[model samples]
Every structure is written in structure tokens, then in C-alpha cells.
Target: MSHHIVLRVVAKLLIPLILLFALYVQFHGDFGPGGGFQAGVIFAAALILYALVFGLDSARRVISPDLLRVLMASGVLLYGGVGVASLLLGGHFLDYSVLASDPVAGQHLGILLVELGVGITVTSTMLSLFYGFAGRGGDG
Candidate 1:
């Protein structure tokens, strides 16, 4: 097959698997080697791969820089909000015990929220970086 044909085929086959692996990393983080940051990078890489083979314009349509900025800020806010909530509830920063009546359950919840924030921040940062490089005609 020609290079374009091969890339198209490979992208078609690989994207779903990449997304699945990212999800696995996001959810199975507590029990395995993967974690939020890794998962976010994995997810962003998959999208970046699409942009590499397809076009930056197409990728931008899917994930615009403005939206990415909001996402990045939202992630930070989420993490900070959790800490503030903990403090308001009469605990130190990120003290999960104040989040719920049951400390262990609160811990799980806190970890989940923090992991989600980390994942969002990581993914958006990487995507933005990819856009910066690729949009500058680095690939050419």
C-alpha cells in the first residue's frame, strides 16, 4: 500500500485501541502501573496521531485551542476546589476525611476527583503542545 493508504489503515485500527488503553489507564490506575498523567498523555497522543496523519486543521476542529485553555483551567480549578472543600469542612488541604462521613470512602472519592483533574490537565497540555508544533509546520 502507499504511505497514505497505510497510515489511514493503521489509524483506523489503532485509534480505538489507543482510546481503550487510555481509559484503562484512567480507571485502573489505583491497582496498576498506569495513572492519570499517563492516561492523559496516552489519550492526547492518540489524537495527535490523528492530526499527524490527517491534518492540523482537522484536529483543531475537533479540539480548539480556546477549548483546551478552558479545559486546562478547569482541571486546576477542580483540584483546588477539592482542597478548598476539604478545608471548609474542617480539615487540611486535600484531607479526604472531611469529604464524607466515612473516611475511606472519602479517600476514594478524593483520589478519583484528583486523578480526573490530573488527567484533564495533562491531556489538554499535550494537545496544546502538539498543536503548537504541528501548526508551525514542524512536520513539513
Candidate 2:
């Protein structure tokens, strides 16, 4: 990969667009054809493409394993926190209606937060898995 000049150049141009598209999928999911799962996979795939082109060390440096672990935990907490918030507001578990004074507003807010959490967790988990597997391969 280090020697693949064309690949390196193309990757440099494409990676940002890939990341941007992942973000678009994540945010637009509420209204359209994508969601946390799809967005997360795309996000992880972009990072992986970076790893494949620039080396795992570079990718790890860009997004550390330690940070990934923290993100994984935080994402779960974020999702759970939304549920707890709803409960505190006198709603049922995982209920979004009480999150805001207006039920519709609350539902929208809760769904967005929940989806963001899912996206983070999925992306981190996939990337972590990729790193684990990549680490086990030959030193070639």
C-alpha cells in the first residue's frame, strides 16, 4: 500500500467524502433511507479504508483503541441515559414522550439521541473488531 501511489492519492480524495456521507446517513436517517446501523458501517468502512491504505498504525493513531473503548461505553450510556431521562420525566421505560414538555418534541429528541448512541457504539465496535482481526494476521 505504501508503494501504491495511485491508491494513496485516490484514498486521500475519497476518505473525507466517505466520512461526510456516513454523517449524512446518520443524521438523515430520521427522515429517510438510512440509520445508525447503516451509518455506522459506512463510518467504520471509511476508517478501515484509511487503515488499508495508510497502515493500521496510522489509523490507530487517528483514532486510538483507548478512545474507541471509551466511546463504546459512552454510547451505551447515552442510550440508557435517554431512557432514564424519560423515566425521570414520568414516562415508561424507553418512552420518549415525556422527554420534553411537548410529546412530539420529546419523541424527536429521544430518537435522535438514541440513534446517535447506536451509531457511535456500532462504529466503535466494528472498528475494534477489525483492529483485533487485523492484528492477528501475518506480519507480512
Candidate 3:
């Protein structure tokens, strides 16, 4: 891999742009073409590319398996917590109108939170799978 200086440099350059595009898609989803799911998959793809170029151990050092697993669950919890919060606020489960003083604002807030949760879960899940399969050679 040390001989592959071009690959390393190119990947280093591209990874940040990939992450930025993913974020763009994540935030712009509500009003435009992309959304949480697309953003998450893109995010995972960047990480996978990093793993492919630098090797799995480096990626793992950046985000350990134990921590990724927790993050995966945390996304689900954040989504569920939002629903529960809505319920506690006197709305039905997942009903977004109660999340803020203005119903429209509440809806926007709820949707953003839900999208964030979806993004987190999808990203972590994809990264975990990539990590598991990429290390089948026991490299990591």
C-alpha cells in the first residue's frame, strides 16, 4: 500500500467532498432531491473507500466497532425518543405538531430529527457491514 501513493492521496482528497455532499443531501432532503437515506449511504461509501485505500485497521481506529454499535442503537433511540417526546407533549406517536410552539416549525423540527436518526442508523449499519466483510481476510 505504501507504493500506492496516488491512491492514498486521491482518496484523501475525495473523502471530504463525499462527506460534504452527504451532508448537503441530508439537510436539503426536505426541500429537494436527497434525504437521510441517501446521505447515510454516501457517508458509508466514503468510509468504505477510506477503508479500501488505507486498510481496515485505520478506519477502525477512527471509529471502533464497539462505538459504532452504540451509535447504531443510539440512532434508533433518538428516533423513538422523538416519538415519545411528541406523545408526552400531548400528541399521537410521531405526530410532529406538538414539538414546537408553531405547528409548522414543530413539523420541520420533527422531520429533521427523524431524518438525522435515519441517517445515523443507516450510516452506522452500512459501515459495520463493510467493516465485517472487508475484514474477512482477518486483516483488521
Off by over 4 Å in 1: 1-3, 138-140
Cand. 2 Cα-lDDT: 0.92
lDDT per residue for candidate 3 within 1-100, as digits (tens), equals 7689999999999999999999999999999998889999999999999988998989999888898899899989989999999999999999999999
TM-score: which candidate is best? 3
Please write out the lDDT profile of model 2 over residues 1-140, one tens digit for every residue: 66999999999999999999999999999899998889999999999999999998899899999999999899899999999988888999889999888999989999899999999999999999998899789521
**Using alpha carbons, what is the TM-score of model 3?**
0.97
Task: Give the Å error, residue 24, model 3.
Answer: 0.8
- A best-first ranking of the candidates according to their lDDT comes to 3, 2, 1
Taking the tens digit of each residue's C-alpha lDDT, what string does model 1 give over 1-140?
23698888889799889989998999899889888899999999999888877778887888899999999899889999999999999999999777989998899888888888999999999999888877788542
RMSD of candidate 1 to true structure, Å: 2.0
Query: For all candidates, what are the clash counts?
Result: 0, 0, 0
TM-score-wise, the better of 1 and 3 is 3
Relative to the true structure, candidate 2 reaches a TM of 0.96
Which scores higher on TM-score, 1 or 2?
2
The collision pairs in model 1 are: none
**Which candidate number maximizes lDDT?**
3
